[model samples]
Target: MDAYRGFVMLLMAAELLQFHRLHEAFPSSVLWGLLAYHQSHVEWAGCSLHDLIQPSFSFLVGVALPYSLASRLGRGQSLQTQFSHALRRSLILILLGIFLRSTHREQTYFTFEDTLTQIGLGYPFLFLLGTTRPRTQWIALAGILVGYWLLFVLYPAPGPNFAYEAVGVPPDWPEHYTGLAAHFNKNSNAAWAFDRWFLNLFPREKSFLFNGGGYATLSFIPTLGTMLLGLLAGQWLRAGLPARALLRRFLIAGAVGLALGLLLDVTGLCPIVKRIWTPAWVLFSGGWCCWLMALFYGLIDVAGKRRWAFFLTVIGMNSIAIYCLVHLIDQFIINSFHIHLGHGPFQVLGPAYEPLLTGAATLGVFYLILLWMYRRRLFIRI
Candidate 1:
């Protein structure tokens, strides 16, 4: 679990690399093109390596929850106390996400589209599902996806006059999408509509229009399904199944999810979009997450090859702290390196390499902090 979570955090923290800069610096470089594509979020209705970060994080939260609950119970805590802790954790996650988003704003952002906030909103329900039997949990997952799909399909599609530009969607965008699929078009879906009114309920510097990226606060609904999938995986892990059996199950589940998600997308039943956390996306990304868990579990826990994962486990151990630190103090760390190490060191390779150099320094600083915390057995969890 730590290794998997750490891998996700490492991916998140790697955003400091500014892949676009590299791409711009070497537009014709095949390596940069590939890196840029994987690091950046897809504009709409598709997935990328970067897109998996949030799902992985949310999925891991589910993976960790059963273990967390068992630990609490083992400590003699009552159910009420566990509920209180879950509630408190949920509140903290939401507030932390908001606070992070509002860092430079004059007022609260009132947006819940971030992975943290989405997880926060959905966590209580995930906790409830966590306590249910696997069959019950599967039912809940299906219900949530079907209910959300119905909400989109049943809701009236935006009329022809809908202002796609206002939401940063080009008029001719997504050339292949039409008909029912168009209902879930960027910034025109039911979730986007909900945010139009929902975000406005809070005080805002401007009237809430549409999210430029087509993200919606209600994505937490399906995000819970992603987490529920993780919870099921966690439960399987705890069942003491044979290692090969466990790995096979994860691989088979991943294949099923991937195939099912593609079927939905190809059939136009649902588009596999990560931006909206579409039901198809839940399964698609959940499949990848399952495979990742299998790989990590097999290599580290099952095969007993633990040393290579040490670096990732360090960051994973203090994942929350690194999450906050990267967002909050990234610039400070980068600037500090410039002031202390001097520009000569970073500029040695040439000015084109500056972003990469500085990014490396900042990432190093972040990892060192995590390493220190790990060595001292200090993990900050919400």
Candidate 2:
């Protein structure tokens, strides 16, 4: 688990490297281009390494739940006490997401689509589902995914009079779909409409318009579906199947998920959009997540290959701290490096690599901080 998580968090922390700077400096360079592509989002539909970060984090949450619940029960905590702890953690995650988004802003952002906030919104329900039988959990996953898909498909797509510019999506945006698929258009779907009403209930610098990135608060519903996938995976892990059997299960599940997701996208029944967390996306990304779990589990745990995963396990064990550190301290760390080293070392590789150099140093500091916490056994949880 720590190895898988470390891989995800390391990917997140790598955002500091600013590979796009090099890409911009040499747009035709395939190496920089591939790095930049994976580092950034894919505009709307399809997935990127960066896109998987959130779903993986959320999936791990579900994966950890069985172990967590068993541990708590072993300690004699009652259901009520467990629930109270879950509630407390939910609130903290939601507020923390808002607080992070509101940094340098005029007031609280009140956005619920952040990775932390999205997980927080769905977590309690996931906990409830956690206690149910596998059959019940599967049914719940189907209901959530199908119900969310129906809601968007049935919601009327924006008409001609709607102001596209106000929503940060140009009417002529190449990504826009025509026909029934238009129901999933950027900032024009049911989730966006719901946000128009829901976000306004809170204080804001300006009335809640559309998210510039086309993200919506209601994405938590399908995000829960992703977590459910993880939840099921968790149950399988705890069943104590042999390594070969477990490996086969994960691989088959991943293959099925990928096939189903692709079918949905190709038939135009639903689009594979990560920004909106569409049902198709849940299947597609969940497939990838499953394959990843298989890889880490097989290589690190099953094969007893512990030595190489040490780097990732360190960051993974302290996932929450690294999440916050990446957001809250990037600028501080970069500034400190400049103040002490005077940019001399960073500039040695030429001007385009300055951001890369500074970012690598900042990432190093982040690792050191995580290492310190790991050595002290101080993992920051809920």
Candidate 3:
């Protein structure tokens, strides 16, 4: 867990750097690859390492849920109490998501399309659906996936029987189907007209072709399946299975998931577009998520050697807080200041280096704040 956390934190640091254009200055091949691996969000039609990040986070949420809920249940909490607590937590996540979305200067109002909001909206419902019999949960997951597929495939968006070309855009250019949904719904703010238009016209028919519907409602289906997979693993771990047995399970499941995802991709049932959250993408990503959790569980919970994993663990412990802080620091604080490195003693550096210096400075500031919060034991829990 600690190592995983540290890995994610370092990845986050790299992401921050890339986001701020620091990546171009101190361009190490290894760092570039790592950044590329983590930062290259899948273009509409294909999957990439970056696409896995969000789903992985969601998968972790599911992975933790059973353990946390079971811990509460073990303490003799009633089912009603547990359900209510879950709902409250879900609500908090949803509100926090809205808060994040609203923080965007371009957005005029809260929308359910935001990542955190989607998690907030989807997760509790996932949990509720999951708690039922395994068969029922499986059925529900299938129902959603197929239902969503049919909704876009047959009914089409904007209106029933909408023509595909009318909604289509150039293949290589980045597109936003959700933005289109937002536009059609008039949910997007008017400040960003180009973004709004692109988002709204995102194709409905060939979403599986690219980054189509990954963020759309259809994604919840396979995502729920991923959660169920996590639940099964959690149950296995809870059953007092031997460490080797758990490791074997992780390897086997990961292999199966990868294989299945690849098969789906090849067969064209659902091309592996992470943005659209196709079943293939879900299976592949979820498979990786399972293996990662298993690895963390083995090392942290079983092996009991965790000194190096502290950094990421800290970030993970305060994932939401860190996410919000990262955003706030970037959007409002640093950008607003417009502090230049070339002004004084820092004038030794040229214009090209300014971005790097500024990025490092911002990251350093955020890290210090995180360090202080960690020291004060002031962990934010939503």
List TM-score per model, in order: 0.98, 0.98, 0.76
Question: Which lDDT values do the candidates have, in the order given?
Answer: 0.90, 0.93, 0.59
Ordered by lDDT, highest first, the candidates read 2, 1, 3
Residue 283 lDDT in candidate 3? 74
lDDT per residue for candidate 2 within 184-222, as digits (tens), equals 999999999999999999998788888999999999999
Clashes of each: 0, 0, 14
Residue 348 deviation, candidate 1, in Å? Answer: 1.9
What tens digits encode model 1's per-residue C-alpha lDDT throughout 1-382? 9999999998998988887788898899999889889888988878899999999999999999899989998999987888888899999999999999999899888899998999999998998888889999999999999998998988777778877788877877853367788778878888988988999999999999888778899999999999999999999989999999999999999999999999999999999999888889999999999999989999997899999999999999898999999989999888888888888898888887888888988999899998888888888988
Predicted structure with the largest lDDT when compared to the true one: 2
Q: Runs in model 2 with CA error above 4 Å? A: none
Q: Candidate 2 — worst ten consecutive residues by lDDT sum?
A: 171-180
Error of 3 at 115 (Å): 2.6
Ten-residue stretch with the least lDDT total in model 1: 174-183
Error of 2 at 25 (Å): 0.7
lDDT of 3 at 71: 85
Q: Which segments of model 3 are wrong by more than 4 Å?
A: 2-6, 9-13, 19-34, 104-107, 133-168, 171-214, 332-353
Clashing pairs in 1: none
Q: Model 2: which residue pairs collide? A: none
